[model samples]
Target: MLPPPLNHTSSILVIGAGTWGCSTALHLARRGYKNVTVLDPYGVPSPIAAGNDVNKIMEHKELRDSNPDARSIAFATCTRAALNGWKNDPVFMPFFHETGVIVSGSTPDLIRHIEKDEIDSSKGDFITLKTAQDFRNTMPPGVLTGDFPGWKGWFSKEGAGWIHAQKAMLSAHREAKRLGVKFVVDDPTGNVVGLIYQNGDVTGAKTADGTVHRADQVILAAGAGSDRLLDFKKQLRPTAWTLSHIRMTPEEAKRYRDLPVLFNIAKGFFMEPDEDNHELKICDEHPGYCNFIPDPNHPGEKRSLPFAKHQIPLEAEARARDFLRDTMPHLADRPFSFARICWDADTPDRAFLIDRHPEHPSLLIAVGGSGNGAMQMPTIGGFISDALEGKLQKELKYVVRWRPETAVDRDWHSTQNRFGGPDKVMDFQDVKENEWTRINETEKSKKSI
Candidate 1:
């Protein structure tokens, strides 16, 4: 079925070209929006790398423990749907891998959670491992299984996998270009104005370059830089999360060559084999000690290390190596090749703020994916498009009505009031510039409570 026609001639401006921005822009293009403009400080092949490894099978413990937001569940549902769409699409076939994912945790509660969620056992045609010995015998010899408390495994031959993020972004951009979506590489300096108000309502944004870009509505898919574009500072918090990919040597690869995307719940670390790059990609559940601090008014030059002081280069690398040694004893002494770090924007609730601004009803804020943005991109895009076009109001009904004040009730950790209030107008000066350092300091002093 064809997407509904855009109610008006809308020129949507996407602020960032990261996965979220690119995905949202592509969704708009797919919906037949012609005057869409995606603006990113960086050009194609964004510095951020994409991981298609589905660690949901393994990371269930972390999500339940650390993330209690219902939005995460909603995001997961959408992500699963998006994966299904990609798996069925001929063009996206080559980009997705269906290796299936495996989870091994030390807690029975974790196992029960997985089973209860119906994600524990694979519904697909794949062998299930009932014991540690069975898993070791089924795959490589040296793989570690002692850390897991019980032997519960799930293998879905049809479960969704990760995508090559850069490739997918490129594909979406290419398609957007074909659909006549304009590209802007510059950052917005002043407040964006110019919306076609029919009977007192905003229609779109007009760029500083005097471009009268009109639209029936606007969607904000800006990543970490989202707080700068709209007046919802208090409602949306963009925390910086860092992930380091520790490259394993050939000898280390030999030890875990056949290991399925393994989730080590005991240590809060996950590993996946990168067949194309011939390296084992590892990431931990430990949240990085950094916060995003970008100035929208006078945005500075981009930095290779966008993280805060807590994320020291040497210290982070050492942590990654130590984590690998502890989790996978087979590769303890192997020499690490290299490591790359990237930032993820998180919200206060740890769930995505995927709704419209309370006051600025015309503006939709798509920031704060926490770390699940890439996984849920396509669904998010579809939902945003549907919300704007008014086709799926019940689906996005919570988005418009939800408020940031009841964040803790929504499973978010309560903190100081950042955004002034619902009715307060947010400007460039109102942003908490040094908020990251303060948050880091606070975390260091407190125990893991």
Candidate 2:
């Protein structure tokens, strides 16, 4: 027999209906929290922007770089959980491809890391290549032939793969609805007090039409728009990333159709096969060009866009074309058909911020996933659920500690000690005044208990 649901009036309000927000809502619901609500001013899964596309490419770049030291065990744990969820859920299965992933770079160390055997293969396959020829061999016919000079990386047969982002989001939304989570589309005008808060705790969000609802807790997974909900005017920064769907001609598609996701480390270009559509989704890992535009609500508030200039660098396109030609020689002259962009919220250290608010303990903030949010959505939501319930797993504990602030403090103290600075020593009093330090301590206490 299953445990009885927690009989409480504490409803949970989740802001943003995108992948992260929706996923969080779904996870909470699965955990027996019935009164969960999701809010997004723009409605479910906001339109994909150029910035979002580029950030996706950069995420693959990070995987290729494979800084094991930088790996967030929390993220990995969540990714595993999400993968398991998809594997068990019939609705999400079709959207996921088990074709596996391949990574190629110039550095042997990078290749070794990419192909590391000890890495978790439960999500998918992983392989590393010692030579360019080894990398060439993995591709289907017309993929590679010439002596491409680069280190090679390959995915294991059981390695992680990609999902159609829009499709996955839609499925999650459908699932959330099926599980009885309510979605409210509204512009709250920044009046979060009566709408989402009741007696200093999350009740339920009020719609713009003035209908008041109550909930047990409120979760902030609003992505870039999180700042608006939390009044984090200066704390959050919205960044843009780009992605391009280049349709290869029949001949090109025929030659490279079977290629798994490919990351060319030397040129910083990555390509994935959109099998059903016969398009080669390509993008670069570089930050690309960005511009800051004003936010309508705040006078000085600005959001960044990857294609504010609306220009694609010729050099970047050439590099992508060259990679395709060298890696899969069949589509050398194939013209690209279409492309799109998206955005992501990035912290200074590029780590996600997933913890309860310092002042607003009832409000959980789950944004700033940077680019890896989509890939790690399932696991992230599960961990959030764990944290909220005060039952954080060991893996989640690792991620909580890896927050940018904690990492920065650790580095700062190490540097201070290295320099023999007497004044650099920190005390509990100093730590108590620091918000991040307090968060870390809270996490520590939670783990201890």
Candidate 3:
């Protein structure tokens, strides 16, 4: 009812401060947008947010091994440019590491895509590993092979690699604050109850304390939490992932110190060695958690953003255990240091969903990471900003539009998300944190897939 807070000139409000939210805010500030404000329940880069991991892969190569690999290759190239451009900036340069990545299980389609992109390893961008030994050589003495016995893949982008999650967010966050962009954790003011709608336009948002901050434009980048607020529950679903970590011996640590991230797309899991923790982290990329989570604040708001369960579920543990035993046998018996469920937003087609609310002219939506949001750290904000300014490129324009279904195959996003694989964990809540160690001790001590 109060006059809209944002004026006609250009006042912006970005909801859900995760990867895209923070990046958009920082970029907007950099562009000299004076009234950029970000509101988040857990603050930008919430420790629990999907992008807040210790390390996430930043590969530009296509792992799906399909014709779409061509499109993915192009996407990767653009992402690489964005990352390289930002790494030179003193603020963000520190957070990114160019340790490189190794991707096995490349299909003929993947190779063709590489050819289409004119990619050649001799250019110092990638190395084609022809056999199991070649792949294992990149890893510790005896890791990988068996189910992937004849697997041949590429280990490329010597200067392309993973990201230090918190640092990336912190750097951008600091820059945004320095530029006079306001960032607030919803706790102090109030969590966003809903948007302010007047005259058939989204004017602003109202908080629990009965405060209304009007805005001329609102960007919803809440990730998994956007559905309830924006009324897109069917199109977007909050998904879960399990990340399990294991400590390594000094020798194991030394050997893996410079290891590239290992992603066996055909096999359904990805591995990341944490140099700082002297540990190895692995997770299930396919068949992600489809379970529902409760939203404490919005009761009856079924399927709110799922919480990270402390315990690593049995179904995930099996593949994880097999990966260690068959791929890295020596690490098979190591005790798990910790495990957690990482909740992220997934769209119907698994592609990104960044569009304006059909009914509200002032409301912009940027949700649905499909589990690949982290790598976009370099340019997601720019994409969202370009969309907001009506400057998106032809290819990227559709990615930001609202669509009930993607024309492509359902498996289109499976390459990046690797969702809907063989393994099925019918009950999402089958495991709890309290019995995590106990489950490890009793069940999966001597298992291999």
* Model number with the top TM-score: 3
Residues 1-449, candidate 3, lDDT per residue (tens digit)?
22233432488998877777888898888777899888876755575578877777775543344455333544664576567745776766776777677665545654454444434554565778777677777766655544445455667756667777767877888888999988877474536778898898898888777778787899988777676687663567677777777777777667666667776554444445555666677765455665556645548543535664546776566667766554676666777766777777777666677777777768888888877787787678888887787677767666546876553233312333252246442336554645343335432332110
Stretches > 4 Å off in candidate 1: 1-8, 48-73, 107-131, 142-156, 186-216, 246-259, 266-272, 292-319, 348-350, 399-402, 408-449
lDDT of prediction 1: 0.50
lDDT of 2 by residue, 1-449 (tens): 21113343457777677778777777777777777777665545455321122113212222223465434544555566667755666656666665556655555664455445324433433455666667666776446664556545555544355666656666777887898888765456322333465455554566565766555566777676565455543444554433445555677666765455666544444445555555676664444223455667668544442222222344445555666565545554555444333456655455667766655666667777765677665456777777666577654554553244443322212211111112232221221222211112332232100
Alpha carbon deviation, residue 441, candidate 2 (Å):
53
Measured over all alpha carbons after superposition, the RMSD of each candidate to the real structure, in angstroms, is: 9.7, 12.5, 6.1
The worst-scoring run of ten residues by lDDT in candidate 3 lies at 408-417
lDDT of each: 0.50, 0.53, 0.67
Per-residue lDDT value at 153 in model 2: 59
Deviation from native of the Cα of residue 102 in model 2, angstroms: 1.6
Candidate 1 clashes: the total is 9
**Which lDDT tens digits does candidate 1 get at residues 197-271?**
344444455556655555545666656555555544345544432234435557765665545565443334444
What would you estimate as the lDDT of candidate 2? 0.53
Which stretches in model 3 have alpha-carbon errors above 4 Å? 1-9, 62-78, 106-126, 140-150, 186-190, 249-252, 268-272, 293-305, 405-449
Q: Which candidate leads in lDDT?
A: 3
